[model samples]
Target: MKIQRRTVNSSTDQVLDSDPVIDRIYKGRNAQSKDEFDYALAQLLPYHLLKGIDACCSWLYDAFKAQDRICIIGDYDVDGATSTTVMLKGLAGLGFTDVCYMIPNRIKDGYGLTPALVDRAISMQAQRIITVDNGIVSYQGVDYANANGVSVLITDHHMAAEKLPEAVVVNPNQLDCTFPSKTLAGVGVAYYVLIAFRAYLRDQGHDLRFNLLELIDIVALGTVADCVPLDKNNRLLVHHGLKRMRSGQVSHGIAALLSIAKRNPKLLASDDLGFAVAPRLNAAGRLDDMSIGVQCLMSDSAQEAHSYAQTLDSINLTRREIQANMLDEAQKSLETVDVKNEKIAIVYGEKWHEGIIGLVASMLKETHNIPAIAMANDSDNTILKGSCRSIPGLNIRDVLVDFDLQHPGVLIKFGGHAMAAGLSLNASRLTDFTEGMRALIQEKVTDDMLQKCILVDGPLPQSHRNLPFARLLLTKGPWGQCFEKPVFDDVFTLESVRKVGQAHLKLSVRDSEQQYDAIWFFCPESWFAVRAKQVRLIYALSINDFNGKRSVQLMVQHAQVVESLPIVS
Candidate 1:
């Protein structure tokens, strides 16, 4: 399949350039400077989604005045954990103490606000049930809460259904909302709700003494972990969060997680939060209960946080083992079937654990470079629950929605954003559903869309791989999703190569003037076919701090050997 290359002319690619002006715009830290902050704040002046915020704030203030017992129903992932933490801490700062949180267990309670969870909330005698990161599509759950005389206020950023939930939904994706930035993570929306609550308290002449900006670290952690686009608003949230984290003002859980992962807090970047911190937090939810993770975030004592961090670290190890085994099994299953011939890769196993289907789908997508879905049949019933992960330019949610429209009774329920989603169906419909999805993809996705390529910002000299250069990049970044850390292209001559840890290859690469060591994770051994030739490399700059010494490293993304025609060179 031929792929269409997306290229911008040199003169027109201003935003992607490494120039000072472009850097200032994309870095988003200039918001800390008075002049730049004022200028940027002026651009946000026309946004008026604060009206719904005002309504949400009024409702919360009334609940506070009446001394209502509030229960927060949070999702189990990092975004949900951070969102729950932000709300718990934010409300406590507003002098509201009658608050408790419940994170749904991934295995038992499933995702979001289920009827079972709503019943649990009622059993706890909660007057109000506030949802973080979830509850946007939980129509039946919200109805159960309403029937039980419980009010619900939902703060989320997931894609909404055509028929909204019967609750005070405050998602920016709501049809009525006109917020300029629509790319907020669940934590970002939760923070905004708190901002509105703070504004309401100020209007009522109340003193709120907590620093709201301190929660930016949580927001940054979740936003990057969830892979949300970092627009202006999200960028602001992450920038401030990265600042506080680097300044040593982040939660003890985060600090301990970083410590356990051997990541240096002094020079942490956004990737550290996404890859190092968020996964450990999510491991608890994936393997056991998420309460362990939420407790880790909410704990103030370093000792308690360290204990939870250790538990989470242990869980992450177990999760790695589980995922490795599952991926191997899934790949073996793929080999028996003709996955290469299928337009949409849909594979299922009765023995596949539901908790790891999302990871399996991600692996399939990476392996085949196609839209992939994986399901695990429920042990008790004929129902199967699945998760999906998509490539760029493909909207998995929209595709599912289209599928639902075309084939009724096939999808029991599904909801999510453009790139990822979750769904359920009867086990009987699996074959037809797979065929329908493949036909849909073959009709929609062109041949050119299948090949994946690395996007390099520009070329960098080998001399830049040093401590001083690494420090400069680190200080200049609070980088995440869209405004990513710099990836450069270079031509390197390979000196030596050997497989490390089974699949990864460790290489000693030399350019014209300097040599550097690099590692490519999960690369195939066949890539060493042109070991002695110059190869083009795409990589991100990183600092490897080991045993108190730091050095810049190239985290390789992609590489291809530059071949010469016979006798043409």
Candidate 2:
């Protein structure tokens, strides 16, 4: 593992009106000017910049005017749920009465717009079909829809294939598109489509009775939950959305989700959406039909939303149990091999729940600091489906793409992003697939890339290490993905230590000036053997409110004995 301090260009000489700490953090992230930190809706890029939006909007306008029966095909993830909710709400607000949605079953229907999905849409008597969060690579599905006299509009953010679908595709990653921010999530793209649709309606002399900005909350949930880089546009969406959530101006579904998750909407942050709300919504897709999650998001009644949220919450708990058991099985399977010697970790089990394999793969990748693939026997015993999670340098999708190209027909189907992907193959071909992945990883992944790096924003001055500063940092702007939260590295002397839970260390520490309370979570009992009174710690300052009394605390990320220079200085 490597610990590196992020460098800030303090000499750039740009003055900021906000807190110096916030300004420094923003500057460290290469913010060109203070305006970059302004996430107002007015600062967002124009919807016209999204290449296919205008055309898609024109198509949607025709559908709306004709009162065409429309069906929305949504994926089963949180992004899909949010995107689906946004489209459903937006279309209804625009006075499109005949609109319904379909969420694909993860295990049965797989991903994206498919032929069977198109058939379902046709059966629904849909004259037009819109796909949210998916459909860019759905060539056959779009062909089927077009052949069936159903018009299709794709609003996706996935990487596009060389030959695109026949539908009107609005993906930023498309070859010919010039959207400034290519990393918009599927939900973000859907929101852009709504923006363009609103513009189109306004041009056509239609008075919109509803405000579309109210849907910002849904877009914010999806954008942050999808783990897209928090660029300026994304930040703008999330910042405004967070404001709405905090003020209790969100939708019934969002309000219910917040209540069921035990999160105070008044203190909601981007992390809450990613860690708490999104998982509950995603669980419905992972373990069962994602329609439950989507319905929860789309429900207008508070009671209905709460009921759906509770159901999703229960499913999420089951998902956690299944994920834990699968990860345990995966680790036990890896014990036979020298994990350090392997370039990639490939593990599988018979009858392992297919839905939870991706979580296991991610856990394995994080734990071993290596590319990992976790496979499970599909419904058909002759085929095996696997999920791949990759390290920073390796693009897992490209690996699968090249492998499929090199050995045609080896991969039954594959899709995903740089860091994660999914594929299926013949059961007998597992050995060949493992070797191919290992070889491919060896060819692309560097040794340094395998090492985990902890990035710190230099040392925090003692002057700024108080309850006020900690609270300010805690309640600050949405931090996620590329725009990371502030973390600092400094030395502290352990004054006292106590066990908080089964695997946690609560400590009182002292620096040269004062003592601070700190907590090291998930620190196993065995880690006490390596503990030291004087240690260098990488930590984030946070405010902990207990019984309405707020105090500063250091959330320790990593610590080492102060015997030598810090690792990777």
Candidate 3:
């Protein structure tokens, strides 16, 4: 991948009171005023702006007053786990009794609030059912619940279907809902619901002043993990959550997961939550059951949460091994694929783990810079569960929707966000679906979408590359998705390099004047054969707080050889 500097934003000269580089970064991202950079809770949009929030809260009030059985149905990803924990923990804190939850099994119950799952919730004596991270397309499930006299409320963030479900829906993407930020994660929606309900109770002469901000940590984790665009509202949610974590006010489960992942909460940022903690939580769902993850997050005791974290870490290890093996098999299969003309990569393994295909699909997308689909035979052996991952400039979900409409019965069912989606089809129709998807994508995806380029913020000034500047960059904002963290490129003379940590390399390098410590994680085997004396590094500056001392450190993301020395015998 070639390095490309981002275009400078010339609309405004000064929008922030901080450093010039930070100002430029903000302006380039289209920040027009200081308010867009604000991360305060007071800046969050009001819940009343959501179309169905009042009705949803009113229904919740009735459930709380009657002490009716409330069953929350959650998905199996990190967002789902955290959303379930937020609603369960939040409502229970608000003095609601007999609240329970149900997470569908990936192998059995499938995605969303299925009719079978609704019947199970009914059998559990649930009077109300609330779905987190899903249920927008679950028309049959909502119909079944409505027919059975069980009230259903869906708080989702996915794009809406043409017709609505027969439930109290609070999705910001609803046709007429005027919520300002449409990119909320499922956990963010769940948080808003409880916040609105809490306010409603207070207005009804009942002072149930539940600490709403206490759930920000879970909200932050889910928001970052879901990979939603970090708009202004989401930045506020994550900013306060990171603040609480840094101050040691965090959930037992998250803290334990951080400990196991070996991340320092003092130096934590959004990527740590996404890379270290999110995968551990997601592994529970991929391998066995995600309830293990939700229980971990909701655990009251530190010891218990740590135990669950250990189990999750183990499952993650197994997941990694399975993914690596599957990728190897998939890559071998790709050897015969027509790389020049292929628009979508479709790979399948009969014995592959259904849940792990999503991970493989993501890795393939990153490695190939193309949309990828990984399919695995379902337990029934007649069906294939497929996971789709796409690059920017292409919405994979839209592709699936078009494919489903243009040629029906090829897909058993499909739903998801723009960049990622999940689908199932008959094992016999794999070739037909793959070819059809490729043909459709051939006409839709552009050549620019297939190219991989590394975007950087030009070169970092030598004067500003210091401990204080690095510290400010880390804590000044919680960045992700649409709002990106900054990385810069510069040439450096390599003094020495050696292996450290797990599959990592630590380097001592210097620019023209100053020396800095740098590290690269999961270094490729090709690095061992490097005889390069100088290289251009694309890196992020960070803080090293080891042994109670602080200094600037370089976290290298990509490196290209600029000068190579002769191989000495």
Candidate 4:
């Protein structure tokens, strides 16, 4: 494994902050100017810049004027749920009375706007179907909807195909979309549609007082949960969303979920939404019905929201159990298989829960530092559904796209971001598909792409490793995905070490007699090699509060044994 230090970009230091540490961080992260650092909403790009937005808004305006039944077809994920809720609230607030939403079942209905989902929407009397976070790839489904006399509007943010569905598509990543930031999550696109639609309504002399910022928390949650890159526009959305959440102006559902997750809304951060709140909401979609999650997100009252949050939390616990069992089984199987010659890890279980396979794939990717895919039987047991996670430099989605092009009929359906994707095939073709994937991956694989490496922001100065700096680090950026929080590396002598929880390691480390508590959550196997010696630690600064007192803590990222220095007494 390689440990590399980040180099600051000099050109980005024009609008440097007062603190040198902050300036270093800003420059290192390529922050160019004051506007970028401030994250001002005014700095966000105009919604009009998005291609097809005008036509998209035209469809919504038509639906509004005609009083058509509008049913939102949403994907069964956090982004989809938030987008659906945002649309429901935004359209209803804009005086569209007959708006409703339906999230596809992860297990039974499959992903995106399936013909089955469209039929269900038509049954709901939908004259216009607006798809949120999906529908970009639903050619057959859109045809079915159109054939049924249902007009469809697609608002998605996934990588687009050369040919689009026969519907108005508003995706930043689409071929002709000149929108500057192509990294908007599905919810981000939905939010933008609402923005444009509201503007269109106001231009038509409707004095709608709906503030789009009211849904920023949901937008932030979806953006972070989807793990999209935090480009300028997305950062503007997320920064303000965190600001609103921290100020107690968040939605009842978000607040309730945070409360149930034991996260303080007053101190809400991006990770809180990503790891805590989003997972609980997603659990409902993964294990049960996404309608539960969508209802929770759109609940009218605190009591109702809390009830749903509790239920989702219970589902999340069950999901964790299922995930742990599946991961354990996969790990045990991999122990016997030599992965040295393999460029990708593909594992399958006949009885594995399809909903939990994505999480299992993510774990395997991190552990093996290679692309991983976990497959399970579809509800009918005749097809296999797989979720993929990839390492850096390997665009898994593109690989799937190219593979499907090269070997037609191997992949049933596939779509997603570069780092992650989903695909399915006939259960009978598992062996053929596996070989195709490995061969295709080998054609594109490089030794550098397969190498395990960790990047950090060099060393944290001994003088700057105090509580105040730690708190400052914690509050700096609501960081996730592409805009990662700074991780610093340094060598420290071990003072004490102990195992905590089930899989966590709690320890104390010293730098010249100054001791600090640290925790390695989901500690790797390498810790067992360096736990008793002086070690080079890669960690993010964190604050641990106990009984109203806060102290600096090291949230370990990686640790390796190093020779001891004689600087300490």
For model 4, how does the per-residue alpha-carbon lDDT over 154-192 read when each residue is reduced to its tens digit?
999887889999999999999978899999999999999
- RMSDs, each prediction? 3.9, 3.3, 1.8, 2.7
lDDT of 2 by residue, 1-569 (tens): 69998777676688643777777787777777768777767888888888777789879978987999999999989999899999999989888999999999999998889999999998999999999999988889999999989999999998887788888889899997878999899989988888888878888899887888899999999999999999988988998898888888999998999889878786677888988899999899999988998888888799999999999999999999999888888999999887666678999999799988999999899889999999999887999999999988888999999999877877899888899999999999988888887777778888798789998988888888997786566455678889988989998887777887667988888988998999998775655544466888899887666666767889888877775334443
**Global lDDT of each model?**
0.79, 0.86, 0.90, 0.87
User: Compared with the true structure, what per-residue lDDT tens digits does model 1 show for residues 1-569?
Assistant: 22122243333333432444334434332233333222232343232373367668878988999989899999989999988998998888888879998999887787788789988888887899999999888888999888888999988887776788888888888776888787888888888888778877888998768878767788788888888876666766776777788889988878888888888777988888888898899888888988898898888999999999999999999998988888888888778676656656887877888888999999999889888999998878689999999888899999999999999999999877678999999989998898889988887786666777655566665556677777777665556677667677778887777778878877788877777878888886786444556776777777778788776678887777775324433
- TM-score for each candidate, following the candidate numbering: 0.91, 0.94, 0.96, 0.94
lDDT of 3 by residue, 250-364 (tens): 9999999999998899889999999999999999898899999999999999999999999999999999999999999999999999754787788999999998999999988
| lDDT (C-alpha) at residue 15 in model 3 | 60
What's the lDDT of the predicted structure labeled candidate 4? 0.87
lDDT-superior candidate, 1 or 2: 2
Worst 10 residues of 1 by lDDT: 30-39
The count of backbone overlaps in candidate 2 is 0
- The stretch of ten residues in a row with the least summed lDDT in candidate 3 is 9-18
